[model samples]
Target: MTPFLTAYLQRIGWTQTPDVSLETLRGLHLHHNGAIPFENIDVILPHEIDLSDEGIFQKLVVARRGGYCFEQNGLFERVLKEVGFTVRSLLGRVIIADPPDMPPRTHRILLIQLAGEPWIADVGFGGQSLTAPIRLQEGIEQATPHGLYRLQRNGDDWILQFRHHERWQSMYQFEMGQQYQADFVMGNFHTAHWPTSHFRHHLLMSRHLPDGVKQTLTNFHFTQWQHGQVQESQTFADVAALYEALQTRFGLGVSDARHGFSLQQLEAVMAGFAQHDEKA
Candidate 1:
C-alpha cells in the first residue's frame, strides 16, 4: 500500500485487510464516518477546495484535517476503488431547509456495486448522515446508528428521507446520473465561492459520537442528538472555547498551521456567529 493509503487506514483505525465485500464496505464507511469529521472550515475561511488525490491526502491524512462533502467523499471514492470495490460518484441536493425550488446538486455520495447489488454510502453529510450502507430499494427503511433512512422514487429521481420527529422528511433528491470529475469541480466551486451559499459563510462541523450519538457544531453552538432528538446542547463563550471543543470533542486537530486562519478572520467569524446568535 502507498503511504497515503496507509496513513488513511491508520487515520480511520482500520486494522483488517481490505476486501471488496459488503462487510468491508460497511466497516470502512462506518469507521470513516466516526473517525473523520464533516467540516466546512475551508469554505468559511475562503480557502481552496482542492479535490485532487495529493491535495486530499495532504489535507485529510497528512494534516489530520477534515473537509466538506466534495473533499470527503472524493477521497473516499479513491480509497474504495483502491480496495477493489466498484464505486460510482453520485450527486444530490440539500432539501432540509425547505427551499422553494430544487436545490443545486452540491452533495456528493457514492453508489457501490457488490455482487451486482447497488448500495448508498455517504459519510459527508455532517448533520444526521448515514453511518452504514443502504440498499437502493424504494420505500424500504434502512436502519443506521443515527436513525432510520429510506429512499423513495420520484419520477426519474430518488428522494432520500430520514425519520425525524416521527415523520420522514426529505433530505435530498437526486438521479442516478454518472458524475464526473468536472461535475464535482463545478459543484465545489459554487459551494466554496458563491456568496449566497450557506457553506461559504457558516461554520458547520459534525461527527458520530460513541454510544450512537450525533454531535454537531454549528457556528459556536454545540449539540448532541440521540435517535434524532437533541440530548445535549451548549454554546461556546468565545472563539478559544470553540476551538478547544473542536479539538477535544470533534477530534478535528485544527491549528494555525493546518487551517491558516488569520486572527482577523477568526475574530470576524466569531463576530458573525455572535450576530447570528443574537438574531436567534
Candidate 2:
C-alpha cells in the first residue's frame, strides 16, 4: 500500500521531499485551488462519493477529478497528516442564504495544528473561504487576497468572519472537535445523489486566486471578480461551450456522464435567480 502521506503530497502536486514549511503549506493551498478546481459536477452526475483515503487519492490524484467540500478537505487533511502536521476533521455550516442558524452536518472542514496553535485550512469551500491557513483565535484578523478574515469563538463552536464593506459578516460556523471520516461519507452521498440537495439541482464551480480574484460558473453564466469589482461576465449557450470553458479556463476534466445541465436548464435556473433578486 502506498503511504497515505506520499499519496496526499502527490495529490496536492508536491513530490515527496523533506523540505516542508509554512510556505510549502501556502503553496500547496494555492496550487490546489488553481489546479484541482472547486466543482460540483459529481453531484449532478450522481457519482459515487467516497471518503476513504485510497478512494479520494484515486479521484483527486489519479483521475484528476474536482470535488466539493468533503472530497477536497478530506484529502487535504490526509496530506497535512502525512507532512507531520496535526490534523482533525471538523464540521461547518454555510451561512449564505441564512444568518446565525445551525448548519447541517454536511459541511466538512479541517482543524490543523501547526506551530503549537490550531489553524483553519479549508480547500473545499467554493468561493471566499480562506485560501490559506488562518490561526484559530479571537479578535485577530488575517488578511488574504479575498479579504480580511478572522475566527471568533462562540461558546463551544467558532465562527469564520470576513470583512466586507468595512463590516464583518459571518461566513460559516465550525466546531474544533473531532469528526470521523465515515460521518462525511453519508453526507457526501446525500449531496451527490439526493434529488432535493442543491448540488444535485445545479451546476457550479469556483476558484480563488492569490491576488484576491475569483472565477465562478453557475449554470450558464461565468463571472470573474477582481479587486472587488466584477471584471467579466459571460453567458454560454451550449454544453460544448461550457465544457470548453471548464477544460480551457478552469483545468477540469471529468467523464461526459457528469454533464447534466443544458442551455435550457441553465436558463431556467438563471431566470429563477433573477426573480429572487427582483423580489429582494
Candidate 3:
C-alpha cells in the first residue's frame, strides 16, 4: 500500500485492507465517522478553509481536527481511490438551507460503483452523516448504525432522507454530475465566507459511537441519540463548558495548532450567539 493510504488507514483505526469490497467500505465508513467528527470551527473562526489535498490531510489527520463536509468527504474520496475503488464526486443541495425553497449544492458526497452496483457514501453531513454506504435504490429504507436512511426520486434528482422521530425527513437532493476539486473550491468558499451561511452563525459538531449512539453538538445544545431516540442532551451555560465538550465529547481539542483557536476567541463567538438569541 502507498504511504498516504497507510497513514489514512491508521488515522481511522483500520488495518490494511486487502481489497475494495462492500464489507471494507462499510467498515471504513463507520470507523472514519467515529474517529473524525463533523465540525465547523474554521467557519466560525473565519479562517481560510484549505481544500487542497495536502492541506486537508494536514488539517484533519495530522492536526487531529474535525471539519465540515468538504474536508471530510474529500479525504474519504481520496482514500477510496487510493485503495483501488471506483469513486465519483457528487454534490447535494442541503434541504435545511437558508434559501429553503432552492439551495445550492454545498454538500459533497461520493458515488462508488462496485460489482456493477452503485452505492452512496457520505461521512460528513454533520448531525446526520451516514455510518454505512447504501446502494442507489429508491424507496428502500437502508439501515445504518445510527438511523434509517433512504433515497427517493424527485423529478430527475434524488433526495436523501432519514427516519427522524418516526418521520422521513429529507436531508438533501442531488443529481448525478461529475464534480472536481475546482467545483468544491467554489462551494467551499461560499460555505466558509458567505455572510448568511449557517456555518457562520452556529457551532456544529457531530460524531457517532461504535455502539450505535449518535452525539451532536449544536452551539450550546448537545444531544446524544440511540436507537433513533434522544438518549441524552444538555445546554452549556458558557464557552468553557462548550469547549470541554468539543475536546472530551467530540474529540476535537482547540489548541493553537490543532483547531486554530484559543478559548478567548471561542468565548467571543459564544457571546455573539447569545446576543443573536436575544435579538430573536
Best candidate, TM-score:
1
Off by over 4 Å in 1: 256-265
Q: Cα-based RMSD of the predictions, in order?
A: 1.6, 4.0, 1.8
lDDT of 2 by residue, 31-83 (tens): 67766778886555545776788777777766767788898888887777766
Error (Å) of candidate 3 at residue 102 is 1.3
Clashes of 3: 0
Over 4 Å off, model 3: 16-18, 97-100, 256-259, 277-280
Question: Which window of 10 residues has the lowest lDDT sum in candidate 3?
Answer: 252-261
Instruction: Give the Cα lDDT of each candidate.
Output: 0.85, 0.73, 0.87
Task: State, as a TM-score between 0 and 1, how close model 2 is to the true structure.
Answer: 0.84
Instruction: Estimate, for each residue in 1-280, the C-alpha lDDT of model 1 and write its tens digit.
Output: 8776788999998999888898898888888888889999877766888898888888877777888889888889989998889998899999988999987899999998999999988988888788989999999999987789999999999899999878999999988987889999999998888789988767899998535888898888999887667899998888878877877887876553755455467676678768988798
lDDT measured at residue 200 in model 1 versus the true structure, 0 to 100: 71
**True-structure RMSD for candidate 3:** 1.8
List pairs with backbone clashes in candidate 1: none
Q: Which stretches of candidate 2 lie over 4 Å from their true place?
A: 1-20, 99-101, 193-195, 255-280
